[model samples]
Target: MSTASTKKPPEVRLPPKPDLELRLDKFAQLATIFLSLVGLLFVLKTGSFLLAPVSLAIVVGLMLAPVALRLEDIGLPPSLSAAAVVLIFVLVTGSIAAAIAAPLASWAARVPQIWNELQLQLQLTSFSEPLATIRSVREEIRNVTGEPNVTVSVQDGSPVESVAVLAPALLAQVLIFFASLYFFVATRHDTRLAILKMCSGRRIRWRAAHVFRDVEGLVSNYLLSIAIINIGLGVTVAVVLWLLNVPSAPLWGAIAGVLNFFIYIGPALMAVILLGVGLASFDGMPGILLPPLAYLALNAIEAQIVTPMTIGKRMTLNPFIIFLAVAFWLWIWGPVGGFIAIPALLILFALARNLIPGFPWGMPEERRRRLSRLP
Candidate 1:
């Protein structure tokens, strides 16, 4: 009894609880974003062969969706409506291509002569020192790398052989593109339903629905509006070019119309091209400056006046953000990247708005802290 009484009570221990501080799980979120970006870049780079066409088709399909919707409202079957829309799109594209082809061919044939003339003209300029410096730097890099003194002579295949080699892949991309567009248009409702099904609650479903509708409406309307404006820009340029007696006015107009979709850089590039062509075609500074200057004026009006009035201030994006998006995508995928960049930005903007509800873009400190409260 004495020995039992002398024994001390058993030692007790408990697992420590984590601190329940009111801090955001910033590390986890940052890691998730980082990983997601890495994965996206990998897929984009590796699957570019398939993904580029698919992306283009999706953007095109979104633009054509209203036609399909209107047809459906008139009691056409979804498949039939989608088919009709796709057919119309194809016809329009083909017609434009046909219209531009002859002029483009003519311009292409003149490129060598233009290049020669440009070189001759530039020789009397201050550019010679920079060119020599560039050559010297290139040689230095070559010597440092211990590169072989190799001349790569491109083996010129027959045109027929080149076409044969390229045709299958090009054909496949076209098929995939059309197929994706048709399916997306026909099954849009199903896609929406599937998205909603992934959500567990009414609130989530509602938000998802809202996001889907917002994406569809914003993307389609923005694209349509931009298309109309761009068409007008092209027509104006064509008329002006014709008045100026530019040899391939239609081709330049078409090029301007397409390139204008890529903001800032596109117009600058078009100006450069026009300037080069001007130099090639005309003798003096007045003749050389006219086309690009006229274009600049027209573009300024369209950008500053027409677009804002049409697209609305609400739809406008930050110039810095747009520039970054364009640069990033262009570095990754060239022209295709540029084409998708704005649409992608719109989609992301829509998503961010939906996710955070009234979060200001240039978020202040207090607002930034509120991101933790985002649904």
Candidate 2:
């Protein structure tokens, strides 16, 4: 038998290929893009809730990290050390609030009275004389031209109602701030370690370390300098108000100091408040003019001399960028956003320096030279 024609038909075979692998790779890329877009949208939409507490926490943590480290050096466990830091923060904040609370309340009560007094002062001032002349001119024109009947519309709302609405918002903000601070203090080490682990390669690791160190130094220094400057501002404002015989001088001063955190806008708002107070309490242009003048002088000194000296080139950011950051955050999250803008900018600059090699801004030439020189 011819092997009984048992020769089997040639077995069929398929070519080996990498279609599955390619498909998987494409899917992963798509997934990554999708996730990133989702994250970005979430941040843009709900940023106000996340940004405020996060910014406050970061600031608080930066300010307290040294203290926590010191406590650790003295043999305290990390958790205890963190707790101690939180306690200290709470106590300091509480004491400051307590110290200012009564005076602020008193000032709040006196605002309406002050407003009335300020109106009277404005009526008597040299500035008011121009208004009187304008009125006379208008009357003469009306008399000669023959007056036409005019009607006015008024909207009615009580100021107290506005205050009532604001109170809850303020309280909620305070609550969020404190809670965030506590959590930041408690988790700072974990956060740092996680960030470090996320980095790969020796150069990346070193860059991360450098960037974090710079952030720590810059934020701590900035906060300390701000605290000192604000205290001085508050004291100066209080002294001036007292000398000028303004009621609740300390309260106004404290307000000025606190608001100064928001930079140009804060001072402008405070100027309006001071102008109103002057109109209520004093009797002429001097009253209105003096507050604005005093604020201008103090701010000029702070901006030109004290800030430059204390902050130095280490943290110098472009003024235009700073202003835009302020505006952006203010638009996104209002006053709290403005307060956090500088520190947020610092964090952003630091991250960019690390993540994006050879970024143009914020890379100090001298520092590079020194680094290059090091063995």
Please provide TM-scores, in order, for all candidate models, with all chains considered together: 0.77, 0.72
Q: Positional deviation of 235 in candidate 1, in angstroms?
A: 2.5
- Model 2 agreement with the true structure over 281-314: per-residue lDDT tens digits: 6666766678767867887888777776665454
Q: By TM-score, how accurate is candidate 1? A: 0.77
Residue 35, candidate 2: alpha-carbon lDDT: 100
Model 2 weakest lDDT span, ten residues long: 366-375
lDDT of 2: 0.78
User: How close to the true structure is residue 177 of candidate 2, measured as C-alpha lDDT?
Assistant: 78
Evaluated with TM-score, which candidate comes out highest? 1
Write candidate 1's Cα lDDT for 330-355 as tens digits: 87777778877878888787777667
lDDT of each: 0.82, 0.78
